[model samples]
Target: MGSSWLPEDAEGKTLALVLGCGAAVLLLLVVVVVVWTRRRRRKPFDISLEDINNDPISVKSAPTSRTPSPKLPKRLSCPDAFQFPKQSLLVRSMTVDRVPDFTLPPERVQPRANGEKGANTTPLQYQQSLIGSLQPDLYSHSSSFSEEEDNYLPMSTYGRLWYSIVYDAAVEQLNVTLIKVKDLPGRGSHRFPRDPYVKIFLLPDDRTCRTSKVRKRTLSPIFNENFVFQVSEDDIKNRVLRFSVYDVDKRKVRHSLGHVIVPLRDVDLGHVDTYWSDLEPMTQALSSLGEIQMSLCYNPQTEKIKIGVMKARNLKHADFDQDTRFYLRVQLFYGRKIHRTKRTGSRGASVEMDMNESLSFSVAGKQMDSCRLEAALMMTAQRNGGMLTHDVEYGRVVMGPFMYARGEELIHWQEMQAQPRVPITRWHALTSNVSHD
Candidate 1:
């Protein structure tokens, strides 16, 4: 109020002063920022390639394939190089003579794995023990052999039946041939004739005769249905045949016929056969003739398996259209046991279990001469009722067959000495590089 100036002029002058101060501050800030940025960009660095190289920090390179070095001796870490002898040291000293004198031939006395013959109580026992049990009526069929025969046959006076012989030469394999008898017995009204229409079955044992009989039908006296069987191979010098015959007409069955021994020459494996080792025995039982081949092999150097085969032929008569099952029945030991002793002797000799353990071979989906098959092994054991259920897991382990692979198609007892191979170590990097900043 002392210097009464116009309110508008005073206000305008104050606004101008404030605006000018702000503009000056902004200009100073812009200049300082520009100077600082320039100094930073132009500054000299003390770092050098040699200084960085002193540290020698190398960048790792990608891996590349390389021919692996030969495996070192046992002194080095090489599991594959470690080999097991053909025969175990612990059991090597033991000889056949040391075996019990009362033992029976392995073939004649089936292994416990094959349950009691003709007595089928095992399946019933298994069913009862299994979690999902089968109904008793499922297998319940109480038809006696006598009753079965009576129902199937209608008793009638004997008729003059016409018998025609047709040899399916293409389908039949002739191990032995019995030509039709030149002279026929005079027709007579005699029941069950003395010769009983004797038919000379050129039998080479159950396998040969059974294979032959299955393909043909004959009741002729010239054919010996009761012809004793024989197998004569030099290596396999003798084979005793024992089997039963069923008198279906008489409704009678007899087992354990006297043994028939036959001699044979040793077959040269190299020239004759093909062996499938990796395959399961059960597979052999089901395969077709064209597809299946009798295989053989031997491996002396165990680290890398080796094998040879002999005698491979097509099946003459196939039971099933396709073969899916197979079996290997090796007659490794032959002997008999005397009464009173559970043991047996050479005459009552059985298979040498150790020798069987040494045998190895392989099988594949397709025909293959030599192939490496992968293997995995595990053993299952049980606690005989003598042990407690809670301690069963820790009970004494009864080792079973060594498994090579797992799952539904698992194979057992695959020969480790002669088996597939695998790489033990990984590839290594070769190039070394460095990065600079």
Candidate 2:
């Protein structure tokens, strides 16, 4: 009974296997037929020599021995479904012609009776005569001029400043005397005068600034104050004198009036000379703090960046105690935010400092392109108690590929990217107004 049952089961199994094989064959045939049909329906994209020559392209069917070749159309036409306006096929010349003369001919005046003085005047001369009659002569009535027009200054000028400079070679000192100022403009609707003051700076060293006493409620003020600057005869030749005038309001906010710059190179330092100069418009000029030497390196393998602060030169010396120190603060910025900040060890304050320190930041290789660096030279002075210190930023420099950087700052960043794993070193000028972000 067991053998009989086994035989029956085996036969049934063999029949089921045969049916499955037949079904698989039928599915394979269907896939092959579908693929063949898709390939046959695909069209071939063909370009002939005529198309390369910019001639109209024509569609043609496959040629066979039993079928004649189709005729090619000379030109192609747009379909009615979407028609484009016809355009001229001729190429327009790009050469521009000279502008036509639009000036009108000078009008001629009829000759008057004999012995007339201006009968032959042209149109231009006649217009000039009318303008001359309307406008007052500035030079003709010098005594009648108001104080505002006394200096014959431009509209941008605020007023005039009178001062004198003398170089005392024996004492190795330069003396500047502020005489007076005239014709300051009214401040508000009340037409009240300003409480004005003068700030004196010997440029190339704005760290040391001198201020004059403020005079209240006066368009004209007599300072008559003398200030002294200690400098050698050789050093004075390279210096400049800047006078910035300001007006202080009730809220203690100072408003800039104007400025005057005098280069000492043009002055005769051997004798005293008084000069009057117009207070010209104010301009944003970068103060000369100094320069710093730095090196930048990026390693794509480790995804790290290194900034080396080698040294600083021509640093403005501060008149502080012996505990004064100088250091460099390096900040890495990403997405317009500070990612990391590192500072070098402080050194004694001097004209030149040798930091020779390097700082590192961990960053991904992809992030190097979006990162920027800011190096700021800082100064700290210890108070009398020595428990706390005061920190002041001398100057800062930005290095990146963005618009915040200019000149050498942008060039240095580009060099580092070009040469991977190599350090690019350069000297960057430090400015007082560099954006930290």
Candidate 3:
């Protein structure tokens, strides 16, 4: 009887134990499912490198779907740039808009500082003298610019005097330059005749217009009336600054066509000496050849010096041909002496010299010892490239102090002594332009 009861109790206990274990397992599985759902919601989808690198396992390779999208360049832009139409573009002309207060009032015009006799030359008297001095031929021949009819008005101070005319030309867009006037004879002497040159430009107004597809623009004259220019410096002791309008196309130096004298006081003579050093070089040349023969370069206005090529052997026949090429250079010093040397070819031969602009054909000709050669270095405005070239029977050559057409008169050399002896190599320069009509 006890055995039967123990079996029944044991079975019941076993059944209960099995039911509890199954319930515990079900609760653990529910907790794990909830945790897994929460984790999946929080994390983003991630592709593993291993799966991406693996080849698709298929019994057959799949056909490309539709047309495969074209492979694009890594760089988004095309190699060639997108071009815009130039014809459609229009640049508006820039006008001065307004003229600032630039002129001096009549009351501000001060009496000449050099006293009445020096600076007080009446405007009417000055104009009379100026008109008297002009070459009528030049004024009549020059038709490009209008003739001056206004009475001359003396510009105020030296700063105003220098800047007024300069600014006026600049306003009208003309190429006018101011170089220091040099070699002014003291009081009443006229040995050094060098006068400072100011170049006037009557350029076509066509330059201001741009190319347009519809139509071409017409140009207008820069000024309607002739300008009366004058200067008054209270600093200059004896000589007064003066200016005149002359036509270069007509090729005339009418010193008085229209002139005004301004008395300048406290004039710095030190400024005049700045350009004096340029006179010392005469002519400088750079050559790759060992020898050269120099010919005097003369001013077209006054060809004071003439150069001829002569053979070292026959000092008589200075005539040269293509076959008789020699490096010949002659520098004329101060329009007096000719320094001709055998700049090229075989050395050890004595070259003969003759004066009077005549060639003496003799082997033992006497040397003109009295003649002295000096450099007449004058800084002038450049035309075209501002490079001067002379054509000779021998060959073409380059000149120094690379000058270009600009209003700048800045010195070529910092000091006379600082001038370079020989060019070590070629050099490039920046260009500047001026327009004062």
Best candidate, lDDT: 2
Candidate 3: regions farther than 4 A off: 3-20, 23-25, 32-198, 201-398, 401-437
Instruction: Please provide, for model 2 over 1-437, each residue's C-alpha lDDT reduced to its tens digit, 9 standing for 90 to 100.
Output: 53565677799999999999999999999999999888777723355566756733343444344476668976645344235445644433566588767988975565565676665777677667768877665423222224455457554348788788889999999888887887777797676889999989887565587899999998778898899999787778767788888888999867777778787888877656567777865433223456888998988888888898998876643544589888899898986899989999988888778889999988887776687888988888788679989887778888987445645687788788889899999888675532111
- Residue pairs of candidate 2 with colliding backbone atoms: none
Identify the superior model by TM-score, candidate 2 or candidate 3: 2
TM-score of 2: 0.40
Q: In the order shown, what is each candidate's alpha-carbon RMSD?
A: 39.4, 24.1, 28.1
Candidate 1 lDDT tens digits, 45-123: 5456566667444221333355646797656454434465545323324457565669666533222345544334455
Q: What's the distance in Å from true for residue 312, model 1?
A: 37
The C-alpha lDDT values of all candidates are 0.27, 0.76, 0.29
Candidate 1 Cα lDDT to native = 0.27
lDDT of 3 at 10: 91
- Looking at model 1, residue 84 earns an lDDT score of 53
TM-score of each: 0.15, 0.40, 0.18
Give the candidates in order of lDDT, highest first: 2, 3, 1
Error of 1 at 253 (Å): 3.9
Tell how far residue 287 is off in model 2, in angstroms: 6.1
Model 3 error, position 215 (Å): 20
